[model samples]
Target: MEAQVINIMTYEVIGSKDKAVAVIAYGVKTPKKLAKNIMKTHKNIKSVLQKTGERTGVYRIHPCKLLAGNKNTEVIHKENGFSIKVDPQKVYFSVREAEERQHIANMVKSGEKILIMFSGANPFGIAIKKKHSDVYITSVEINPAAVAYANKNNKLNKINRVRNICADIRHAKLEKFDRIIMPLPETAISFLDAAYHFAKKGANIHVYTFNRSFNEAARDVADTCHMFNIKCHKVGEHKVLPYGPGIYKFRIDLKV
Candidate 1:
């Protein structure tokens, strides 16, 4: 029998022992020290945070996870493009979202601007700029380390089309964007107002949400549009990301 295709993931090897494995969802990586710092920060966020022994050289990381343990841990590396500085333990899941973000980038023409809210390490911006040379992209991230990582990624990728903004989206003075991307499904619903406020009159908004059915998701988008006083329609339906067994998160695009 062939090996089963498990969930998409990213992993890294760390430490002299090579005993420690840093895994990420969909094959992402972060610096070892940064990974350790993330663990420390996780401890500050929750009292029940478990201490995993630190190792050097390699580790796995899952990026899309809001929390650590619930994160996708399985990771493998294929010879596409991989980074070693970003330890796998601290960052992983963004490849699919990166693809979506790249799609948006291709849609951009010269002089077009885009805003990405909840931009973790500015992955969306990176994708956009990487694909579209003439786009001006702005990325906002709340976490300081993530902001740093985003800046580093921009430098690493040698992309000049993005501006990494380090601030909470609620307070950022955002200009109108030709397109907008918010991949944070769990937290994005609450920020529809912000999305509306910064969105251009006819901007394409891509949102991720957890809805049991397509109708539910459509209704959810409708409700959010109504609240924002904007007309909305579904542009497309992408893959349903697996949160766990039987639980799925859908990425739905809306043109508003």
Candidate 2:
């Protein structure tokens, strides 16, 4: 038996070994066929969803429609050494950022205070706490649902030091942090001033941005620092993922 490929399957799976859910990107031309293929290939994946629209607004969540099997979207996505109970429809998350989160975790030093902006389901916070139990973490997110999930995930991971703040980063009242992580690639650059506001001297801010090239990403960071009247240096740059055609999401580390 042979079946022609309707379109290249661009999808990601969430959950652990027992059961999982598949999410297909919005650009997939034949999502149903792709969902069928995903279900066939991954026996553990019991539910499939396809994106109905691009990620819009500040929430970074898009509408999703069930394409196959059960309609459940909530799943305990386990990675590294922690588990996060999240509903993809209710919050923004990316299984593809697993390694990126790990890298950010590895950058942390013990007994340091860290802040994460646009924390979503607090995946980066979990990753850091799992690796270094001595560090204190604070996560700020605007979406109430995501903040709820972030708290639940903290308890699920048995992590006790994370403080979840439900508000815009600009309005968040907090002390200075030794390190900061900004995962919102769409408009992270615009929030550099906020990051600087809560940053201690000699702090490192890991900012993720999408641009045509790494140089352009670094330039944007430099320009933002200049615009904010903050003294900073570009310490590192990393390609996190491919966002679109000829566009890459880069992590530009700013040392203040």
For each candidate in the order shown, give its overall lDDT on alpha carbons. Answer: 0.58, 0.88
- Which 10-residue window in model 2 sums to the lowest lDDT? 1-10
Cα miss at 128, model 1 (Å)? 1.4
Clashes of each: 30, 0
- Per-model TM-score on C-alpha atoms: 0.67, 0.93
lDDT of 1 by residue, 185-218 (tens): 7757667778877878778787778777777776
Off by over 4 Å in 2: 1-9
Cα RMSD (angstroms) for every candidate in the order listed = 10.1, 4.0
Best by TM-score: 2
Local lDDT at 136 for model 1: 83
